[model samples]
Target: MSEALVAAETPGTGIEPVPGVSGARQFWRRLRAQRAALVAAAVVALLILVALGAPLLTAIEGQDPTTYHPSLIDSARGGVPIGSFGGIGGHHWLGVEPQTGRDLFARLVYGARVSLGVAFAATVIQLLVGVVMGIASALGSGWVDQLLSRITDIFVAMPLMIMALALLAIVPSSFPRPVLVTLVIGFIAWGNIAKIVRAQTLTLKGLDYVSAARLSGWGTWRIARRELLPGLAAPIITYAAILMPVNISIEAALSFLGVGVKPPTPSWGQMLTAADVWYQAAPQYLLLPAGSLFVTVLALTVLGDGVRTALDPRAASRLSIGTGRKREAKAAKGETEAGKSASAVGKAATEAGNGTTEAGKEGSA
Candidate 1:
């Protein structure tokens, strides 16, 4: 009745069309099917919400993270104060700092803003550059592909950490720290994403939909955008999921090294660095930020793994092999029916000619 239904019903090609669900729907469904990914997603979502709602949370706590509480510090306790590492039930929920009695909870909440923002920004840039370069490399031929491929290879060959350090050295520390860090990390780390995209594009560009678009006089960029891009979504997202934790780690490392986001601007890495010396006095100082980083990275990594496994068609093939076979069998049945109809037509024609001859002979007799 409908064009979509007609198309869905029609079977012309050897490759069977997967019915019912659209690609986006299928991708989401697959993602939902992954239990580990779902849990990781929830954790990541909670982290993001916490990061986004930092100001509100701080306001609710009535604690200014940057404000020093010299009164809260007890000099007799060997720099460990009353509020520092004091159990959860007080005005300072996560306790206060050792020297400067800043609220740890407020600082942690605010620090998440910097960490998530930088990581997400860098990841966005990485995806944009990497996906474009990769698709362009796949679309081009001859010298174009060669040049792009060589450029990607060169980037991959370089020691990215060293390159980032060198680049950061030139940037003024007082410059927009998060933006600079994001650019440096994004520009330096897109090689792996490009490689993954390039390989995926190379495979996808050869598909029937892409070929059909090409034959219908679509420009390279148009075909790439409309035809190849959707197919590349899963891998691109999967790569991105993998890249996020790496980006976060890089930001943390730079902050820990003191070249990253300067003082007064809180970061988990900076907190950890500050807390290192206080480990002997208050273990919570070292544990808080370190534990946060660990959990964030671990959650992201698990999410990535879950996404990879969920989207892997090869892995899922066993479950759907029977359905695939049924499609093949249906196609085969259609062919068999076509052959039977052709044979029936030929037989009927033969019988009609025989009847006509017999009538002519009987009439003549």
Candidate 2:
């Protein structure tokens, strides 16, 4: 019984202790504590799942979204039509479109595919262009940097929307494929990213690691790939997150202007265009797509903010208790050292006083 009690009292003798927290673990622990980041992650995950699984879900309804249904309302009298409001004694949940009588829910689902696809593709292209241009300019001597910087400046000063509009006006409204629109947006948007990447590269190139690599006879490409790129990871991730929303917004705006993703494609922007006439009566039509865009953009912005905070060394330090604990430990060490000095001084003073008194007594004697 006593052995059992001792064994019970002993703290997990067979179990290993938890490992010490690492920098990554500490950062993740801090991030998890943030309520906004948690919520934003959840929302973004849900959106991604919806975007990817849209086709599967739409097929389960036994409805063809692309096919036109002329008498959707009349059909709903017997059975629910694709877009009929569920609780309103109709087969459709969101109500049928007045002109085409298409399913609103189905269209929204399909639209997600278009919006997210374009945003991702454009972001990737922008990153590639920006990273290459920025690194090239940073590695090159004065003339090359100056030329690239001037070109970047020129593009930055130009109105992007105006340029896009002029280009679309000169060319056909419909492109050969969706990729063409994505390429156009990506090519135009890369100027901003190039400037950002250039600035970062300039700062990183002066670091000791970069200098050491150069001193070791590493070429520019090797130095950039090994030394500079690793340092740029945080900013690259942050920039990518922020750029996604911008691309989405640009795609929507172009679509709204009748220059992006031709009609009948079921884009959120195209949905908005269709809802313009019914703005006063059936505001839900406009509100649905607009609301989706607003939420998606807002979610991306929040996620980007979270990523920025997480990636920033200063912000991460502020979030972690490590900084405070380290400061306290340093102060304690300092105090200990001070106490030792005070004790040494007091001992020396006592000894000197004793010696002086003893000498005085001896002289008096």
The candidate scoring highest on lDDT is 1
Give the lDDT of residue 28 in candidate 2: 60
Which regions of candidate 2 are displaced past 4 Å? 1-23, 73-91, 313-365
Candidate 2 per-residue lDDT, tens place, 1-365, comes to: 11111111122111122245444554465456555777887888898898898888667654545765666644544333333242222345466565566766778878888898889999999899888888888788999999988887887787878887777667764564356668888888788888888898998888787798899999989988978887777778878989999989988898888777776787888788878876664666788889999999988887777766655524332222555468667877998999999999999999999999999999999
- What local lDDT score does residue 214 receive in model 1, on the 0 to 100 scale? 91
Clashing pairs in 1: none
Task: Report the lDDT tens digits of candidate 1 across residue range 25-45.
Answer: 545565676556789899999
TM-score of each: 0.78, 0.75
Error of 1 at 40 (Å): 1.2
Q: Worst lDDT window (10 residues) for model 2?
A: 1-10
Question: How many collisions per candidate?
Answer: 0, 7
